[model samples]
Target: MGDTPTTIWPLDDARPGEVVVIARWSPSAGKSETIAALLPELIQQSRAESGCLGYQAYRPDGADNGDLVLVERYADQSALDAHRNSVHFRTLVLERIVPLLADRHAVVTTVQ
Candidate 1:
């Protein structure tokens, strides 16, 4: 029997795959639901974008509502940037959705 050699891919090799963005949007008093209502369109439009791996919007269950959390995954930096510059993002999210928020925070990272 012949022996086979093992192959190892570097950790950084996986980094070229995608970028993840985690964000929280806390709308002003009485506006969370309004913003929440708009999320479906935002998510749908974003999903239709090129290089969009995953995009989601989440809100508190029941009456303990607080902030809206959005988790987004893109194929790379260029894809993420494209999403940000898209008409949907520019109009729906940046112009309309953002104004409803009292606070917003996000973190972006590269992922496999």
Candidate 2:
């Protein structure tokens, strides 16, 4: 399959051929184990989506405890929207995982 390009309004800095989402999550007090347990399933299901080009979760070496970084690539804006509205995203991320997080930050970008 080939890459699909996308554009974001206003700022308009995104390049063509895929949208990338970078997110950081910090688990709430004593909720680290729970968040970790949810990662594998989340990653697996997300990667299985047709619009998802890639889905990966990371923990920085020497970084603060219970911090997770997720890097995801999708075909385009529609693909990303579909992912955000997907059943797995709603259930596993918004409901199960988000409730255990102290904070979460995400940014959308594209290849230069």
Candidate 3:
């Protein structure tokens, strides 16, 4: 009998797959508007990526929690990696937005 190797979708050797990332960002006091203002440019730049399937951001309804939710889809892990390495992500997100955020949370999943 031949032995079959076990493999994980993303952690193992998967290629040309689908990935989804959901992120929540809570802005620091008085910084919600600043983050909101930057979202348009962020969306524009992100959507222009070759491997980006979808990019959307939302503000929770009822009361101002100053939290922004982002749902992003990519063609594969490489695409997601590219997104994180992009100039806009580095400058706008890591540099500008991260400093203004009180907290941030994210989850990454691969489509089966």
**RMSD to true structure for each model, in Å:** 10.9, 7.8, 11.4
- Kindly list the per-residue Cα lDDT of model 1 for residues 44-94, writing each as its tens digit: 899899888778666534535568767788888999999999999999988
Clashing pairs counted in every model? 0, 1, 0
Ranking by TM-score: 3, 2, 1
Reference-based lDDT, residue 50, model 1: 83
Mark the 10 consecutive residues where model 3 has the least summed lDDT: 1-10
Select the stronger candidate by lDDT from 2 and 3.
Answer: 3
Question: What ranges in model 2 sit over 4 Å off?
Answer: 1-15
Q: Which should have the higher TM-score, number 1 or number 3?
A: 3
Clashing pairs in 1: none
TM-score each candidate: 0.80, 0.83, 0.83
Give the alpha-carbon lDDT of every model.
0.77, 0.81, 0.82
Q: Per-residue lDDT for 24-87 in model 3, tens only?
A: 9999999999998988899889989999887878765663878988888888899999999999
Clashing pairs for predicted structure model 3, backbone only: none
